[model samples]
Every structure is written in C-alpha cells, then in structure tokens.
Target chain A: MGGSTVEPVVRESVGSAPGNLAIASLARTLRCVECGHETRLEVHQSCPACLGPLAVTYDLSTLRGSVPSDRLSGRPRSIGRFAELLPPLSLPWSARLDLETTPLRPAPRLAEWLGVETVWLKDDTVLPTGSFKDRPASVAVAFAAAQGHRAVGCASTGNLAAATARAAVRASLPCFVFVPAGLPDSKLDPVRQFGGQIVEVEGPYDVANRVANLAAEAAGIGVVNITLRPYYTEGSKTLALETFEALGWNPPDAIALPLGSGALLAATERAISQLREIGWIPSGPGPALLGSQPDGCAPIADAFDAGSDEIVPVEHPRTIAESLAIGDPGSGYEALRAIRASRGAADSPTSEEVIAAIRALARTEGIWVEPAAGTVIATLRRLREAGTVRRQDRVVAFLTGAGWKISHAVALSRVGSAPIHLDPVHPDLSQLHVGPRPEALGGAE
Target chain B: MTTLVLASVLRQSAPSLHQKEYDGFRGSLLEFLNTVSAEGGPSFRGRIFDGDRLRRYLNVFVDGTDVRYLSGLATPITPTSRVDLIPAVAGG
Candidate 1:
C-alpha cells in the first residue's frame, strides 16, 4: 500500500498563469547522442545539425535545494508536483490527474514465487488511459500545448493512442493517432471515446508507423513519439523517480523492465545515474538492469545474446504482445549498451511462457497484465535459474499496462477460463467443480 | 555485395534489408548515402552527413558494429557485408 505521495487532506487549488507563456524546462540543452553537439532545448526531435537522438541533460545542483521542500509533499500526487528535475512546461496544475502517482507495492506472494527477498511491482496500469503511455503522453501534449501547437498526434501500437488522445483532450487540442488496422477495438474504441480521431493504416504496426512519420514531416503535426520525442521520451524517468521515492530512497538490487524500443530500460539507467550524481542514492553497485521481451520480436535480447553491437532489423515482428512487437527498434543500441554496462542479461520468453506468466501474476498477485509486462515475469522466472537474479536481491518488476486492453485476445482464448453455461437451478456453489489450472501454473516452478 | 539495411524512417523513401542488393559495390559509406539520397533517400547534403563524417541523427553500422565505434563511414565493407542505417528516433 506504500505509494510515492503523502499529501494533506485538503489541498489549495492550483492557480493558472496569465497568458500561455512557454516556460523554460530546467533542461536547457540537448546533447546529440552521436555527435555530442548541444542545442537549445524546446520541443525538438533529432538534433538539427547531426540528426542524432538528442539526450536531455539537466543541472542537478539547481534541484537539490528545491526538490525536497515541504510545500511539494503537501500537494496532490502528480508528475507536475515533481517538476524540479523534469522538463520545463506550464502544466495545468489545476487538473487533478496529470501523470498521477502510481503504486510501487511490495509483492510478498510474488517474492515467494520468484524466490527474491522483496519483490516490488511498479504498477503503471491504473492511469487514466490504463497504461504507462500516460507518463509520456501527458508531458508531450502539455509541452505541445504550451508551445502554441494547434493540434497533436502520434503513431501508436494502441496504448499510446488513447493516452495521447486523453492528454490532448485535457489541453483542449484535437488529437490524431495513427495505428495499424489490425489493432483490436478494445484499444481503438477508447481513443474515439476520448475524442481522438484514429487513422487506421492498411498494414502492420510498422508500416502505420512510417505513414505517421511522413505525416509528422509534411503537416508539421506534433507527433508525441516522433516530433516531440526529446521531451516525450524523457517522461519515462518519472517511473524510476516514483519507484525510488516509494522505497524511501533505497535503490533496489535489480529491476526487470518490459522491453519495447528499449527506451524505457535505458531511461531507467539514466534516472539511476542522475539520482546517483545528485547524491539522492549512494554510489557503488547500482541495480542490475534486466530487460525482457517475447521471442516473437526480441531484437535487443537476441542481439545481446549473440553479443552483437548492432541491432538487426526485424522487418516483420510477430507477437501476441502488440506493444513490444516493434521489428526495427530506434533505441535498441542504447538499451543494449545499458544492459551490458550493468553486467545484466537480456532474455526472451516464448509466447506460451509469456501467457503463462500473465496468468500466474493474476492468480498469485491479483494483477492481470498483458503479454508485454508478462515477459518481465517470465524472464525473471528464467533468470532465477541462471543467477542473473538471486534470492537475496530486492527486485522490482515494472508492470507497464493493464490486461483489459488485451482481454479479448487472452481472456476468451480458451474454453476452461471462459464462462460456463449454467441453468437456473445450478446457482449453488457446489455445482462449480473447478480443478487446478494447469494453464496458469505451467511456469510457476 | 553490401546490403544496407535501412531503418523504418529511411525505409519510407528507400528500401528495406531484403528488398534490394548492393553486390560488388565499391565506395565509402558517404558515397552510398549520396547514391541513396539521389534516389530520394535521406538527404545527406550538409544535413545528415558531409564529405567525410556523419552529421546528426543517422547511425551507420558496418556488419553488426557501429561505424563510429569502428572507423566512421570509412569502415571497410566486404562484398557480403550488411550495413544498417538507423535514425535517432525511438518507436513505441
């Protein structure tokens, strides 16, 4: 039940500033990842001069005195409340929900199952959009709105579509999210409900992604992950920040992250190093950063296993985990470097193992996750045997999204877990003869 | 043959890994960029790369190692090498 925030019962309303003045994010310059060229920070994509991904660096000395203030703790739980270390933007602090604080609960049962001493679940599933995309989408939309952008859009697998739309709606901007036509209605319907227009492409998620980039280039649309990426990707550090705060500033021994483009795992590494530099956490042995993926599209994992420095493009990634099904990941190199530096290991669990892990988390911990997060659980299970994770280490598994988003593909897939036809007289509890669920318990050992 | 595996962003204009071939090609990676740009690939004319070094967002890998880690665009390639051209963009 321990979370990141401790606020007063009654809070003062957040006031609005006169005229939408674009406030400077404490992050002043973005250093090009490849060329090391620095540029003035705003809503930026790749570096203008070098075209390499720009890395946002902040002066931690400025925040050391301001971050631990008593006034911040008394306010409600939101990402804006901890804006001292984040990118500069005038968020509607008046709104109750903007990257609200998520739970980092200790899972005793899960610890016993994984054989770790203290296993924690950083559940990002309870956001307004039912996914972790809320973190980046909230920041990107706010940054775009503050910069006087008339509209916003993004290319998404599904989770971000709804998240960007919801964030855009909060800022009173029309949202356009392009996704593959194959995405389920459970994912697409929410975007419509949140007033986001969906442009369904007639191909897989990869092709749809290309069209979105082209749109971002031609129409000058503020694509959350494309055009506004410097700020958008930086939003993931909040996850690491929240986790550290939840544990009372004690860093865990290991963290298992669900791998996609490999940005989240790399971002976790950046957060760990930043916190260390500012003396928030002690220096020495940092947490072993572990990354997991389904075998269907495990480019980073496969590359790490083969000890290859370059990421081979996965042109047609096939997987039940729609979120992690990126064939050609943009940050594959960064994630691979972080994992290697931490002396950590990466692995891919088969789709069956991923499904079993999903059911195991639900059965044991009452947490239903899609295959994306399930890869972490399944990978940790394997790591327990390989000594990448040990019984003495305190582990944190990041549950990135909720199960309802993929319930159609998972819940009703089998007959045993489905609803049984019952007659009126069969209402008695004795009529239900449910035995052991081998499906869920397949990978428990 | 040096097969250049372009990223999704570059694949928008150029071809993917298997779609094309660069058999028995002899040139530096910069010339390859100009050739691709001439064919409507990412324009490296003082924007992405110059005569000698790559400029901003694009990364080139000879075989499976980054050219920056190897020898920049001057990294030699074999007839059967696979080079990857990736942008600095991160996908979801």
Candidate 2:
C-alpha cells in the first residue's frame, strides 16, 4: 500500500494556465466538507483523504468592499455576473450558451394566504431547459469544454437530463444520459431532441447513477454530477445570488426550496455565507434555509425530524413528484447540517398535499409549477401553521420546474362536460337551448 | 479478531469475500482492506481501495455511522466493532 502508485484519475488534456491564473489572484482551495482535508483543484469526485464531498473555498478578503452594488447591477443578468466567486472556467460568454436569469416575482396573494409580510417566488421555470438544473448544467458543460473533454454525461431523474443535453449540444460536445426505465415521454423527448444518447436503465435512479459512475470512471467521460461535481455544484449558488440581488442585496428572512439531492439548498446557503463574507450583504446570519421533500422520498427530512446526523436511505421511493424522488440523496448530510445550522426546518409533504399545493399556487399566483415546486409551497403552508414561519417574516419559495412538462401527472378532480358538436357549414341551431330572455332592467325592450 | 460484512454488490467482485473474520487485525481501516485484498484477490483490492484510500464511491461503516464522517481510512477497528462496506448509492 505504501509504494503502490495510483494513476491520476482525470487527465489534463488541456493547459491548466487559465484555471491557475483565475485562482492565483484569489485565495481559493478545495476542502472536504466532512473532514477539512485539502483536495487538489481538479475534476475529482470526492476528497482522497476522507472520501467525503469536496467544496470550493474562496478567500473573500479581496472581494470585500470592492464589489460595488452598482458594479454587479451593471453586469449582464446571468450567473456569469458572479464570476468572482465561482470556480474558474475558460469558456467565454460569447462561446457559451445563455442560461438566462429567472424572474423573482412578488406573490402578494401568496403572502396574504400565509399571512406573511411579503413572499417572493424565485421562479426557475423560465430557465433554458425549463428547470433550475440548467444553472448547474451551464457551468458544468463549460467546465468540461475548458478541460478539453470531448464528451459529457449524467444520470438524471428528468430535469437534469434535459438541461445537460441542451448544454452539451450548445457546447458541441457529445452527451450521454442514463435515466430509469418507465420515465415519461415529456422528460425523455427533450433529451433526444438535444441529441443526447439516452440509456434507459432497468432499475431506479440510484441504479442508473451507479451505472453512470462506472461509465464515467471506465471511459473517462465527464459526468457533471460525478467527476466534475466540485465545479458543477458551484453553479447553484447563483440561485441565492439572484435572489439577494433582486432584493437590493438584502437577504430574505426565510427561503423554502425543494430538496432532491439537497445540493441546491446547500449551495444556496454557501452563496449566502460567501456574500456576507465579501460584504455584498450585511454581516449577519443570512436567511433561514428551509428544505422541502416529497413524502415518498424524504430521507433528509426524516433525519432532520429524528435529530440525527445520519440519513437513512429509502429502499423504494414512490411519489408523483418524480423529479424529487431521490431515495438516497448524496448531499443529505450537508443539507441537514445547513438546515440545522440555520435553525431551519425540513418537511415532506404527501402526494395529495403536493398536488393540491400545485393547484393552490396556480389559483392564487397564476404560477403553474411541477410537483417538486409544489412541495415547497406545501411546506411553507405547514410552517406557517406550525408557527415556525412568522407572519412578519419575508419568505421566498423557489419554484424549480415548469408545470407544462408534468401536466399529465396533475389529474383534474372534475372533468368538464363533453363539448356539444356543431356542423361547420350547416350549424345545428336546435342543439342550443335558450331560456326565456331576462326582462329589461327599466321595462324597455 | 474483527468481523467484516461485505455488501451484496461487493459479493459480485469478490466471490469468496463475505462475512469473514480476521484474527490479529488490530489496524486502521486501510490496513484491514489491504489485508483482505491480499487474501481475496486483486479484483477486491481494485473495487475497495484506490491506492491506500478507500474508493470515494464506497462507504465504510463502523457500527452504524459512515467512517468518512468519523476518521476515514485512519479510523481504527476493534474486536467489538462491526465493519460494514456498503456501495455508495445516490439518485441523480
């Protein structure tokens, strides 16, 4: 074990000058989140010392008092605006595809319903692939290109496959996506449309992920969530940045987001901390980060409820919220830590609750969202009822995916009456039954 | 002596490696893995450890908690401790 030499997993096909130059000025390092072991800044999956997830650490001293509010405002409305804080990427803005900034709309009706001071919907349904996954896919694909990888791939539930496929096509890189069998055509069609080679695995998402990981290591393919995870996760921080910027660089009182792998919630917390450190926002505990999951697959929420650091994996996840049906969340531990540290609460809404919340949000705010986003809405209502979220607190719920993609899953409780047929050329007037006309208001014809 | 429980997935790689007991194994997790590899085969070694460290995709549990969260490869194993090697399974 002592003398055996292990070959480097990721080869440097391209020059590291760009990555080195980017981080040279700033004090940045990759550190293990669990054991604090320093890892090399490369396309590695996990820390070599602890085998735990690795996160990028930035020295915000240089950024403090330097990033003026107006300077950021003047930049393009994209994740690239926060380039100073993100991991180094070599692709220029002109070469990369635009992952547009999503709207942060104020939901007055939702606020009134919750009895909160204000509620803003961080609507990510408007993203390139109609989900928040495009945020990370954009950065990850660009990173792959910079690293001179000719191909990119990932194991996805639904949203991520589409996002990765679109990004890969835009970057002119061959893409391979593995998803579980029996996935709906709504999610599968987009992957094919974007020229991704889809491999349908026989088992659940976890099995698909395992196969993807094997392919990644065996073939040296750049799997966004596996090999290039360290850089890929950095893109999600932009969600928080966009929210803070929308609020005039002020952190909200609380934020509720749907949790799948828990990466989004954890990354958002990371962004808040970084913003505070760089003096972009006031120095205080940022927002209380609340996490929501589907009841069928709520391992992280269960651990949070039990007050245990260990997350027990659900063997068979069953849920209408297909996007959030991750039984064994890779980022569960980190997400639990973030939730506890922020004094936040995690909740898992039942399938019925999720569907109802979807309808409720659409009726109130005219924002149609997928079941994953519905989980957030349902959790917010629960928190309000439980007195965890106060009436005066400014809350923001993250609407992650578009409703149209999953329209088939939302069954209407009542079906409308069949349409009455009428001939186009010769209309049947007898089909229309008219009652006696109402009397004139003033007895006038 | 300490008993090591191999996950179902690991059985495919190491046919002979199951719930095996090893005597005079007072060492770190890395050493225990190396000892097993020496006795079992190279396939077991390749799947379990990357060089001297446990593979990033595999989880080693002492009792119920993950060893990576504890002390990683340096975590000690005693006769009273039960070691379980579980393949890391995650949804995308």
Candidate 3:
C-alpha cells in the first residue's frame, strides 16, 4: 500500500488578462475569474484572488435571429457570413473577405471505418490562410481597424502569423508577427508573403510569445492575441453555427477538436448553447465536446484525469504539429469547464498515431491534414473503440487546417505517394532497349 | 504581510518594481520596484526600476487589460481591484 501512494500535484493559479480593453458602448466587458468582477474597462495584470485567468464577458443573453440559410449563400468565401455574430463594424465587403461559411462535408467512409453511422469534417483548410486561425484573426483584425488601430500583431507559430498578416493586409494595415526562429519554414513562408515585419526570436515559441506580448504592450499596438483576443475568439463560434446549420440545425452527437489555446472548445460549446437560446434549434442533448492534443502537449488532458481545475505549465514543446505546439494554453481551465458542462471528454494521441492518422486521411478521405488534425481524427477512432462515441451517433470532427501549410510534418511522417522512377532521358529509344516492358529495361547495355 | 511586486517579466532584465505601497490591492506591484530613478530602475512608463522588470511575454493587468492601454504604471487601482499578469502560455 505504501508503494501505491499517489503524489499530489500543486495547482498554481492560472493567470490571464483581457486580450484588450473592451469598448463601453460595445456592451461587452472583461470578467475576473477569481472574484467575478465585471468591468467596462481595465488596465492591469493578474487577478487578486487565486490569480486565475480573466475572460471576456459578452451579453449573449440578448441574442436574436437565425441566419437564414440563404442569408449566407452569397457572401464571399470568407468568415463573414456570420457577420451578425461579430462585433459591429463598417468596412468594404471586399476588404473584409469574410469566411464565416466554410464547407462541412460528410465523412461517412471514415465513419464506417470507425464504426460510426454519421460523421462530418468541418474543413477549415480552404480558409485564406489555409488554417482555422484565419477565422479568428479575420475578426480580430477587423475589430482592430474598427478601433482605428493601424498595426496588428500576434504571438504565433505559423498559422496565426499568416492569418494576421493576410487580414491586416486586406485591411491595409501594417502587420507585425513574432514567431520562434525554429518554426518550420512551411508555416513562416505565408507570413512573409503577406509582407509583415517578422520578428524571429532565437529562443522557443514561448520566448517569442513573450517578446510579442511586451512589444504589443509597450508599443500600444493591437495584438490579436493580446488585446483583440475576446473578439478574435468570437469568430470561432461560427464553426459551431456552421456545423449545426450544415446538419440542418441539429447538434451532433460528438465534436472532436484539436486543442491549442482551448478557445475553440469554449466557443464551440457557446455556439451550440446559443443556437438553443435563440430558437434557431430546439434544445437537445448537445454534442460531447471532445478535445484532442498531441501527446507531447497534452496538459489539458493531463489535468482532466488529475481532477483539477488548473494547469501545470510544460516547457520545451516537442511535436511536429507546430500549429498546436502551445505549452501553456491560457484557456485550458476554461476548456475543461466547457467540456465538462457539455459532458464531453478529452484525450491525447502519440506522435506515431498522429502521423498514421494523417496518412489515413490522405489515402482514405482525399484530405491531407497536419499532425494536429491527425490527432483529432485518431482520437475520434480511439473514442469509437472505447465506446465513448456510439456507432449509431453522429460525430463531427473539426479539422482545423490544411496539410499544405505543414507539409514538412507530413513529409516527415514517412508516408508518400507511390514513386515512379522515370528514365533520365529518352536516349535512343531507352538506349536501344524496351518499349514499356520491365524486362526490356533490365538489359545491361 | 508579504508584498509581492507584480511586474512584466522581460526576457533578460529583472522584474522591475513600480510602487512601494500596496496601492490598496492584495499583491502590490509597487513594492517590487528597486528605485524610481529614470535610468537606474527598470524601464516602464518612461521610467526605470532595478527590481523585477516586466517580462517580455508578460502583460500586467489591473483588471485584465494591459496597463499600456491605459496609463501604464500610472493606472489607478482600488483596494478590491485585482492585478493579473499573462504570458502567451501555449498548450502542453
């Protein structure tokens, strides 16, 4: 019994601050996680009690209207279809390039293999930046412009930098991106293409993030993750909206999403709940919001089983899926709450399994996904095997990004299309050898 | 009572102190300051402190928003107002 003793993990206060100040007329505010203090404006760091993370408070209680299916039919292929859900702003439609209504295709083949009758993929790869980060960055950058801020910044891996730069460019604002020096070239190229002032620190992604936050603060720039976070995350709710609408306004039985900052998980839950509140869809047993993280960075998953409401920070993130390589998710605790409230579970997959899932997606579904999406798909399969997801239920998997953005990870997965060795040149009709026969090419001329 | 000076933890410099008094808040960031000199202390609000300088990734919030967005170190606080600091802690 002495050998079976369990060690205690100290739960440190999870600290968070508003991404930015809330405009008073916006009717939204920042809420203190420790003391539940609601304020129209604030300019400080850390909470007094327990020193927990703070969250943006919105008046979703007064929400109204269902997005007429046709209402979104003609918007540009951007995250703008759900403009009503975003903060009020005025900009040319072209400048906005909203992508609120991305495609949600059925994954019945995947479902059959996983023993599930219904499944769908919320494909965000086609977004302008080739990842779901574009969704939030679009809104965040738009809000920045609405506030008359000219420069937009972020602490990013690859996807957020790309999205922020693209959105800032579309809005004709200067963009500043801070990313780690070791970030994969595949992710960094897009950010550079957008003509952003890239600040590549020599340290890890966390170190780069530190520099970005400080720069944003000192320069008073509108950092998307720093100040525009609340509004930025609001863009993610559209994923849930589009998911339910694609399913005829009915919630799915389960939703498996890749966990990075945990904002997506929280936003998805709120979207489903809002659908019920606004009468767009009748309230029913909502989807079980399962989150998938790479084994290398599964702190939230660790906390879930530990039965704690806090997170223990992990340094030196080691995952090929750099998009989800966040070591300390600011919203991890909140994501835990969001999942538990929805009666969902979270899990992590090994790097090998993630790679296998990526290959499977490419071969079976004709969709090439990065390691993060692979983690989600693999987790969905695991849940099916564990009976957490029923065979007769509908499962919706949120594939956050495209494979092209992080093709380096996929290439490193040791999975490739069948190779075709071509003749170096058509030298004298294959050097006076075969026409198309393998044997004729074997002649040792 | 132990006064914990809360300031941004910059990459290389020490956590700069801002004030000496509690400012009526539980964790007084002021007590962490080394001095109030222009060049001697850490740089914040156009001033320097030799104590714990604000970290680069860290953002000091009186209630949640960055002090830079308000009046920097000069942002007022009440006895009940909570101060928070945040760094871009990714998942793991």
Q: Which stretches of candidate 3 lie over 4 Å from their true place?
A: A1-34, A41-78, A93-97, A416-418, A424-445, B1-92
- Binned by DockQ into CAPRI classes (incorrect, acceptable, medium, high), candidate 1 is acceptable
What are the per-residue Cα lDDT tens digits for candidate 2 across A31-125? Answer: 88876988656776766544577888887665666545544544456676666677766544213644557799988777777677789999999
Among all candidates shown, the one with the greatest TM-score: 1
Q: Which candidate gets the maximum lDDT versus the true structure? A: 2
| DockQ preference between candidates 1 and 3, better one | 1
In the range A322-408, model 3's lDDT, one tens digit per residue, is 877777676777788888888888888888878888887776568888888899998888888899888998889988888988766
Task: Check candidate 2 and list the clashing pairs.
Answer: none
Q: Which is the leading candidate under DockQ?
A: 1
True contacts kept of each: 0.53, 0.25, 0.14
Docking class of 2: incorrect
**Native-vs-model 1 lDDT?**
0.75
What's the iRMSD of model 1? 5.9
Q: List the residue pairs that clash in candidate 1.
A: A25-A88, A50-B55, A50-B56, A50-B57, A51-B56, A51-B57, A52-B56, A52-B57, B1-B79
Q: Give TM per candidate.
A: 0.80, 0.78, 0.74
